[model samples]
Target chain A: MNSTAQDEITAYVFAVRAALGDLPEAQRDELLEDLTEHLTEVMADGEGPLTDRVGSPEAYAAELRGTAPFVGGFPDPPTRPNPLIELRDQVLPVLRTADVKVGGVLGYERASDFGRLLRPAWWVLRGYLAAMVVAEILDGGDQPIGLLPRIGGSDGVALILLAAGILGSIWLGRRSFRLSTWPKAVLYGTSFVLVIVALTGFTQADGYTRDSYYSNVTSYDNPYSQVEDVFVYDAQGRLVTGARLLDQNGQPIHLGNAYCYDDEGTYADAPEGVYPYCASKAPFRMPDASDAPLPSPAPSGISPSAAEPSDAPATPSPSVSPSPSK
Target chain B: MDTTQLLKGVLDLAVLAALRDEDGYGYDILRRLRTAGLGDVGDASVYGTLRRLYNGGLLTTYVVPSDEGPHRKYYSLNPAGRAELQRSGKVWQGFASTMDDLLRERGTA
Candidate 1:
């Protein structure tokens, strides 16, 4: 028998078997016997060739089983429901759009399965670009040159660092954006670290300037006579109060017997002006001069006035002053 | 109608009528239909109608094993099938008479 015919016969047998499942065993056997006998007799009685008259095994089986044969030509058999259809419908649209955008990044004219494989690199490239944007926004003002003794001028170093950071970010971004997969992740991560470093460097430079101003103010014991709280310590590290006063050059100006008092009410008498008074309470606000050239400190042990003036202002003359009467 | 077309509609009824007296297989049914001047009836049409009627609960079928060739399926009408045949036969008779009346009247007119 032709394969198709055989298949049809098998299908007919299966269908009959299915329908007969509800029948009692004896009835089922009888039905099968009857159909077989009938088919055999029909085939024998055919005047022409049995195949031509009775049809193929499949057609014969279909007719015997009461099924309609192929009317015009065989149509594809009805298919079972596909479970993936729902998921495919939902996911395909988003995937297609993403493929378009990512394909452009990868320099592809059309998206294909091969192009989709580059998605990991595309994400990394996006990350790198984001980092570069952040870094651009964060670049800040120059550092104070007065803070670092070895690095010399802060302006040059700040400008150089800023330029290097900008160039590095651009380089990393370009490199990452060119890639198609996770290798771009490395570039993105590096860009992120570079941006963080640049921000930290700017912050540290600002902090150094503030700390330098504080140090300058603290160097003077007392520029004004207004009393301030003083933390005085004895030789043994014992806390003492009422420390003496001094100038910005650290010179003691007063002489008297003054008693130092602890919060516990004990008073220890010392030479009145021996202890240095704290200057923190006297708010010595520095001039707002971010643009002014910083005044370099005088040589190690030299007094401010005695230092040779490289760019200091001229001193005022006293020859025109009036004499005071006794 | 041509004998072929006429036979198509009544083929099921004719097969049932033939099996009314005794059970027969495919070849026996074909032989009887031929003898009855229904030679124009295709062999497939008869066999197909037999199977259809059997499936439709009008005819009961049984296999008789043969020593020489394949086992033969024999068909017989049960009570329900016979009653159905009688009812359909009556309806057909009525319709045929009506058609005959109309055709004769037309002819005379």
Candidate 2:
């Protein structure tokens, strides 16, 4: 018989056998021993299908059983079903229903039919994902991912690997169904793991895109990392606290950290353009400052004079002379 | 009345009679019976009758393998099958005549 004819005959026989399931095993086998051959003959001379010629398999099985109850050395009827057979009997209906229902939702006769159509697309995708794993391994996973993996930082290798991977994957996909049970199981396991690896690789690739898109805002090689606060000084060389620095176009000059703690340990925010983020932490000292401004030539003689006129002209001369010369 | 219900009673005899003239496969026998005007005789009924008669030692089967595809199983009536067919055929004839006479008087065509 042709393959289609063979398949139909096989299905017909299988249904007949299943319909005869209540009979003992040996009895059922005896009844169906010549079924395939018989079906082949019946289909050959029929103008229509085997079902149209013979009727439904169930009705056929009933007619077969109607004859000779004691002919085949019948054994006692089956006491209980084999566990595996029981499981199959219970599960087949639900699975068949799901196959039809899911298939209907997908606009196919069966879900497996839809799955068969997607196999080639999956083969290509699986090949690409497999190549990514290889590239990641070859590159030691250090390089940032691009549109395609550059194994060992070479575009040529990436293209070759991609072609080989996709072709090889398609080749394997075509033959996978024909594999023996054990090897097929192994392939299924590896396919699942490859899916997980692909998900992780895509997530990392997404993060890389975000980093490059916002590179100016946050960069690992920032030049001003050590600058905690900015302290502006005028040409007179006196510290200008609360000095807001702006660019030539009058845009605020934002640099350095803008937050600090005062001497009293109170938190403060002196956003950029307002230089000297913390006045108390300024690099330069003013007249009568807490650090005494500088080493006084006479600690006792001038210190009291400078302190008495805290805002007076005497502190300015002392503060100015020392700053310009030093 | 359903001819299928009637065919079930005489199917074994019909199968034996079909095999008497020439040995035939399952489908060949079905074709012969249909050609002989037992159009309502089913495929399974013939095949099933063949199996039961074979088991009862009244028919024999042999396989004829073809070069192209699946083989054919040919059934032929043995001596016991021929004898049973003749016996059943006579009984059917007697029943039909008796029914015919009873119906001819009681009913109009």
Chain A (alone) TM-scores for all candidate structures: 0.24, 0.52
TM-score of chain B of each: 0.87, 0.90
Candidate 1 lDDT over A101-207, as tens digits, reads 77677678546755566655544543443433443444343533332221234456545544554555456555655797777777656656656755766697788
Per-residue lDDT over A166-236 for candidate 2, one digit per residue giving the tens place of the 0 to 100 score: 99999999999899999899988878989999888779879988988877743465554445666544433
- Provide the lowest-lDDT 10-residue window in model 1 chain B: B42-51
Interface RMSD list for the candidates: 8.3, 4.9
Best by TM-score: 2
> Which ten-residue region of model 2 chain A has the weakest summed lDDT?
A317-326
Q: Once superposed on the true structure, which residue ranges of model 1 sit more than 4 Å away at CA? A: A1-39, A43-48, A55-326
Q: What lDDT is reached at residue A285 by model 1?
A: 21
TM-score of 1: 0.30
Q: Score every model by TM-score.
A: 0.30, 0.45
Local distance difference test, candidate 2: 0.74
Which is the leading candidate under DockQ? 2
